[model samples]
Target: MSENRKKNSALKVILIIILVVGLAVAWIGYRAFIASSIATSEEYFYVHTDEPYESVIKRIEDEGIVKNPSYFNYVARAMDLQTGIKPGRYKLSKDLSNRRFIGNLRGGYQEAVPFRFQNLRLKENFAGALGKNFEADSTTFLNLLNNEALAEKYGFNKDNFFLMFIPNTYEIYWNTKPEEIIDRFSKEYAKFWNADRKAKAAALNMTPEEVSVLASIVKGEALHVDEMPEIAGLYINRLKRGMLLQADPTVIFANNDFTIRRVLNRHLTIDNPYNTYRYKGLPPGPIMMPSIASIDAVLNYNQHEYIYMCAKDDFSGYHNFAKTVAEHQVNARKFQQALDARNIKK
Candidate 1:
């Protein structure tokens, strides 16, 4: 009987050891599964394209994005983070769990980035802004813009290429290729010129691109949003009358001088085709990107007999419209006198 008791006691000891080991492992597995892996101060984590998986792990550690790097590594191994390295900008919270974080990285779950270019003045500036919002280098996009074949592929020349853009933002992946972005914009541009907008452009005896060019002038000249249609109407009237646009904004654009508080006679003397005061009809292309409102204003311009416009002497950002050169000259002289009174000579 004593021998039996000793054997049973030994068996119980082995059982207790096994139970303790199992519990310890369960605690570790639970901790690894539920632990807060992302302790990052940043709202998003970036992984670059073609980056090695090991380098990504190191970046997570170096950036202090994980609470415990070892726990994250163990979970990553379970979720196969090393096998697939998806490059993207992922939205991460401060307290992301190891399981969820690893799953996001492994499954290529990324947040779409927004890029609005409505207000960018120059193509170079637009390309630079794109670089800031995406992974591709700024020059990559600029090169595509400057490429003649690529521009022709989209049915535009370098001069009229700016018309392809809608100036509104769409969902873009952070790591999208430059060529892919241009294609996407081209598709969006096609969609934007639907039958309705096309009919409007046709009714005005203008193509979509021509309307965009005139809209850019309207956008540049009108300071207030309410005055956009009026300005567009005035330009359209001039186009119908076969008169020189004589837009001061075009003169400034031709001279590449934005600091010119006033367009001078010397400014209008530039030989560039963009100088509307010297050239007839539209310039080579749009001087700046026109917003949707500005574009629509040109499509739905106010019809009136007014052939000229001058800024109000009251400095209220409103324009005084006139039907004849005599009335226009009077308005222009008042505005010139107002500028002299304020000493706004450039």
Candidate 2:
């Protein structure tokens, strides 16, 4: 009976050893799984449209954010992530588990890209800037801007469709469609033209487009915001008197040569309708994308009898205004002498 007790005791020792070993192995396995299942780096992973599971796996491997790509692939397959792939920009962190990463991918949680633009000179430049901020390319954006049908559907034509985009920062998804961008701008434009602004436009006897056109000219003329109101007033005076605007900026625009430092009699002879000296009234479209301040300057123009302006001889970006041609010529002569001293003849 003592021998039998000894054997049973030995068997119990063997069982304990096996149990301890099993626990140790289980612990080690759990640690390895946990270590490999979480993102090892903080970065973003983008999944584009029509990308397959293999492509996504390759991209993650290329990014080197996952601790173990093979293990991540196993976990992704086990969770059936392949069947629920979503397209968007996904931000990953070191603490994010493989399960959570896959969940985020399947849920379509994306980061919004911030897009801001101001003082853009041309539609092409605007398109290029917008393309840099979003997934769409410049050509695609330009095509949409030039699409007559699309522009007409949004209550604008290709020539004036650019007026819809207000200069501001907007939070939009990176994958936002071009049409959606235009629609957003249209909505913002409508909101901007509220009752007060509409009343101000009416008081000036100008439509929103006309105001924008004049504002563009004002923006081109005055570098200082404080000077915009006076310049706008001077232009308004010319309009009221049925006199040719003869704005040098309009002549430069008509020539399509922004490099011209001085507008000469030759530049004034340009046959374009934008040539205010050759053709009276506002231009057919804005010369550049006008700022909100310039637009408001036109809406709240200063009352004055001045009908002519010449750039100040001081090179201070301010203009000298006059009601009579003699006074304008005097101001013009001062500016001309300054230009000649600076050797700026074009």
Residues 1-346, model 1: lDDT tens digits: 9999999999999999999999999988877888666777798998999999989999899999888888888988888888876899999986678898878777889998987777767889888988899999899988888888988998889998987988887899999988899999999999999999999999998899999999999999988888899899999999999999999889998999989988888888999999998899999899998889999999988988888999999999899999999999999999999999999988
Backbone clash count, each prediction separately: 0, 0
TM-score of each: 0.94, 0.87
Each model's lDDT: 0.89, 0.85
lDDT score, candidate 1: 0.89
Model 1 misplacement above 4 A: 1-20
TM-score of 1: 0.94
Tell me the tens digit of each residue's lDDT in model 2 across 1-346. 9999999999999999999999998865554445535554555677877788788889788878787777677767877889988887777776676767777888888778778898887899999987887777999999998898988998777777778788988888877887798888889899988999989999988989889889999989989999999999999998999999888887887888989998888888779988998798988888889899999999999998999889899999888999899999999999999999999988
